[model samples]
Target: MGRIVGIDLGTSTSEIACIVDGTPKLLPNSQGKLVTPSVVHIGEDGGVLVGEAAAEYLFTRPDCTFMEVKRLTGGGEVLKAHGKEYRPEEIQALLLGYLVRCAEESLKEKIERAVITVPAYFTDLQRRATAKAGELAGLAVERILNEPTAAALDYGLANLKECKNVLVYDLGGGTLDVTVLELFEGVIDVKASCGNNHLGGKDFDEIIMGRLAEPSDSADPSADERALMRLKKAAEDCKIALSTREEYQVSLPFLLTGAEGKPLSVEKTVRREDFEDWVAEKVNSTREPMMSALADAALTPGDLQVVLLVGGSTRIPCVKKLVEETLGTVPRSLVDPDLTVARGAAIQAGLIEGSINNEDLVLTDVCPYTLGTAPLQHGIFGRRVFFDPIIPRNTTIPAEKSKIYHPAVDYQTEVTIDVYQGESSDPANNERLGELNLSGIPPAKVGKESVEVSFSYDMNGILQVKASVLSTGRQVSAEISTTGIKAKAPLDLSRWEEAEGARKFRPLIRKAEKLMAAGGDPGGDVELLVRRVKEALLLKNTKEAGDLRDQLLGMLEALEQLLQLQDDRTLGIDRP
Candidate 1:
């Protein structure tokens, strides 16, 4: 059997890594590219292509291609692209299939199990959706590891320390996760975690691009779209450039159409100083939140042994500086900022498969948000709690916690229990998950009766909610149903199956001969790129994976289209 893989299924790009022999090794795709684009193409022939090939051909063949499908996750709404609406699961599946195939090729065998990682703050449904994606991709998911927890494992292995308090600041492509972990005697204990699903490195890139790109007030819509796309692309290029260079320039082009509908062009330039000055405020905004987390844990920055950084965004010089300035110390850089979680996850997968023993290693994870229910008096007074959390944020998971409540009125036969998952006291300010109806309650005087409400978040990040009427001893327990978010409109996948049926699997092989023939190694960051592709491939819910695959592909296709013209060009350019 092929070895189980560890995946960092990122928002912008995904990665994969696995334990081979006694050391962890990264895997590359057929293109020999380290990180495969988390993209999927719906070909004109009704076939599907995932990874670099799909991404490369997206802009060159936009009519049938779909990309950036991950945005549709938890959307509960169908997305329209290439004249068809796709469900999230289907999109994710395609990406997973591509990854599994890549792994099979590498090991020259079948792989059936894996340890997949998710954002620390992903909701119950999102977690389920992720696991379902894995199932669709044809692997038995051994476990779902939190991204920060995985990073901690990596840290633990490298340090081999006796005990210490380490904070993991995981800033990924689409989300920001801050976790406080206590590492001691082979056990990794999670104290707390906080995150925002809407925030991450992508937001940073967009903010930089949005500020630098010039607006076009042209009458042609298509021209406007193409121009704006270039502007954003230019913004992204500048952001990447600034990461490595002291300064970078973005040229804003003005396309002027002649009388015969031909075009003329003009250019303007933007420097790194102007770019930094514009984004400084955005960069500083994260400080207060980081401080708040420390405050909650009752620990000053000086209390930490290390402020370990994870995620590709940490590559930004400004980010690193800001974090150091905030903490008053230089943070540790033991793992590659982008590949930390992927490697940690791979290490854990190895232990689970007995390739690496758990005799001296243990890991713990925490909840990222608060979980609770509506106040007893508020509902009686016509007050509604939206996302009142029963479980407070950062509580350790796979551990049980509970709170008690009393009856609000006399002679009440049925009680309404509105459950929520967030930190705000006001329900309207939080996310209203669902409510429970506790029936058959014995009629009682006001404040004469009570119920014990319990919440349990498991290692997989799934929540189990329960309520027991103390007086009657009646109880109910359930894994909270996350049907609150509507499912996406289902797309017919028959065409995809038919296409696969007709095609023979063309495997990617890189023997010594092939590598030597390639003239040299694949290039810089080849290992990092390979790891990203493997991580993305291990994500398997067919529908969601398929959708994410489509979205990522679409994004890459858009970029490829902009990058296709072979000319003297810098990475960052403002097109519009």
Candidate 2:
């Protein structure tokens, strides 16, 4: 039995840790750095490179180097490198293998098992993909621990005797997760978790990129992969620098060639205030999830004893301010945000392998999403399919719940149990996990034949559904298989045509679009505001859309004035 380790496989970076003398300690990578860039590069010589070494290739060999593959986990999208196609998990496996080898070298012993952490809101397919990546890295995965839960475990281990409600706000490079849990007498019971998988620090970097590239309209810099990579790196640097300083000078010389075949550059001074303004909406977006988590936990902000901050994104001043304002308490970063999740993972590994006593620390988690079957229901519109939740979101894990449903039509001999995962009332609006056909339901009146569906979600977040025909005593079961599943498409908003208030936004939306097309707005502010307005409309959030509409009108006026001023200056006409 080799040693078990803990790993945080993150979007921007990854880390490995282990328990030593009952304390979780991070292990430095091959380069002796505590955190490794989650970047992979395939060399022309057929060798694979990861971490900081591979990060350099991202600039020179952008085609062969891949970063941020974590965002694509569990999707069927294929990544091409060195004339070969690789799945997202395979790319992650390379990073994992590199980390494990480095750890083995440092410890002078083999590590055979690991407890890896993912966002609390990761889906069943994503979890399975992460587990597969671990297996490919040649380790037996002990558990797929939620990142926030792991952070809570790390904190709870050190405060075993305390009884208090805690909240973990984790905003990393590519995701945001808000979790509420209770800690009492060595027990860590999670209440709820909520998050947006598509939001985080990377988004902030993009804001900076847009700001930096605003001055250059002669060419599309994004068309050049190498140029885009350089700009991305510079944007990230600017973001990090502005964290401490009020302003940072972004100087990217010869970034790309202009339409006229001349080298173009990007030189600008980015103020922290401006950056915050640009990202305010995104930062504030975390509020809803935070409030939702607290509500699900049945705890108010005043009830929280401590708020823990995890992930690098929390280092942002605006992000911190938002958390403080929303939670009414300053978040504590006692453990390094960049390192906490991995440390917690290490603690979990310790508990599993007996490095730490199970009696001294116990942890329990919850399902982050709702799981249910779609059954026919009699509604005002006659018979329609509605989602019937078997296990609602935030319910304690390793939980099982069953529901009884009858056949929809008389003499129906079979019933197909369509399982879904989401909160939408319509099954079509949610993700369809899989379906089980329970045949042999002896033909009888619709009300006479009944089928009972059982959903069992485990500690790992995997779902197993079983359907039984009561009278026939026949059964069918299936573990939802998401292997090679295609990535989900963006929410369909085509039905917005018939939405009640959607008509009112068309003229405003059209005006914003025209202003954006006029292309005088430099900071990309006009574009950002317009996109947000459209998003609000898509969500049928009339209130938010209305508010954004007013903002967009004001922004358009300001942009027009700025553009007019620029034209006047270009024409050598000065106005008092």
Candidate 3:
């Protein structure tokens, strides 16, 4: 049988692994290293380079190198490198092909099928994009496993006899994912997963570079592509150094030219304390995801037996402190965080290939996003269509959920089903997955004729939707496409007007009202902002939503403080 290798296709770095001699091991790349830099370079000499060679190419051919292509996966974003344009997934395919070649050379055998890991929060578009990249690279993608889930699988397998609630904190180069998993007997069930794909160690590197680079409205011609690339490399090196050292010296000689046309230089010695202070806000951004995961699982930090740290970013001393403070425990650092995902992928590959006989290692995943359809709702502003989630986020995979939707008009014999993925009360506010058309339904009065729509999300992340007429047993079904393009636009639901505000944020508004009822004085300002933010999000005004969210968050913080003080007074205890 052909090998079903496990691949950790990452934004900043990638690794391939396979089970050998009853154990999972990372395969060394052509550079004889386990961690391959996810960098590709189209050479000036009409050649191609990947990994270490490609990463370093930035020093001389900055415009020719492509790094972090994983960020653009399924985003419909485009890139240009070395005067040649490429889709994000195409770049990924090139890198995957390189890794496959390395694996083939190491094993002295062909590898066809493989399991690839992605962020759990990856949308249908992103998930399918990763799988398609694998196919473009000439490998049959066996499974698309979540990165945190893969790591948990590896950890769970190692401690098979023990039961634990393990929280997986994965902060890699370009994203942050926090997942809570229940490991019982031999079954591993993911309770919850949440993350921000735009945040990670790369942000820290950019922060450091910003400190060294001069800010100006005009271009610093002296700091050309090469110079900027040099600064980036230097920032990354210093970041790694500060992980173990108290301080690191950064020096860039002949880095650029000043406006005066003189050769400029950059030299700075950054202290570990200073870096930690500057990056504190970025560190704090990760807390929401952790809290969200715990909330989804109905768990507290105290409920977690141990926190498992994964990804290279966790090596930062300050990051560890943040996790310990938030989770109320010293996180387990024994596992090789950077390689865990790939190694676990190898373990999964083994299972798929029948190379491993551990049938007790039962695994279950959940739909990372809400599955819903647009439905009519009566509101204060009259009738409007809102997002109606049939299956909410965090629901276990291989699970089924159904909801009855009724016709909006009398004697309506035709209906169009628009499926979306998100947890928004407003339909247009979420990602539209696909749409379906059903006809020949028995006509009746408004809200009288109905159909039961069921969403069955399997472990593979594919969604099977079945619509059955209540008057008749007539049924129609459609599957969410892995390519994500199956969802056609101009959904024919445009006539469904939206009031927008006071929809999704209704819960927050009520919570604020409760606090006020309990003697917390948020005033009308908090309520006003909530209403405004909802309108902003509905209007697709993200800038306004962002500003309002900050204001709302601050008001909530103050209200919480008031509640805390009230509790303290009630207990006759001093405020600490």
Provide the overall lDDT of each model, using Cα atoms, as 2-decimal numbers.
0.67, 0.87, 0.82
Point out the worst 10-residue segment of candidate 2 by lDDT. Answer: 484-493
Better of 1 and 3 by lDDT: 3
Candidate 3 wrongly placed segments (more than 4 Å): 44-46, 217-223, 411-414, 437-444, 466-477, 481-576
* Per-prediction TM-score: 0.76, 0.83, 0.80
Model 3: weakest 10-residue lDDT segment is 487-496
Per-residue lDDT of model 2, residues 1-576, tens digit only: 878999999999999999999999999999999999999999888799999999988989999999999999887799997789999999999999999999999999998799999999988888888999999999899999999999999999889899989999999999999999999998999999999989989999998888789645788877899989999999999899988899999899999888768989888998999999999999999999999999999999999988999999998988999999998964464868999899999999999899999999998899998999899998788998899999999999999999999999876866778889998998999988877877655556668767889999998888888887675345677778765323223333345446567788777667766766777654455655655555556667778778877887887788778888889999999998
Best-fitting candidate, measured by lDDT? 2
Model 2 misplacement above 4 A? 215-217, 330-333, 484-576
- Give the winner by TM-score: 2
Q: In terms of TM-score, how similar is model 1 to the real structure?
A: 0.76
lDDT agreement of model 1 with the native: 0.67
Residue 525 error for model 3, in Å?
Answer: 54
Model 1, 473: alpha-carbon shift in Å? Answer: 4.2
Per-model clash counts, in order, read 54, 0, 2
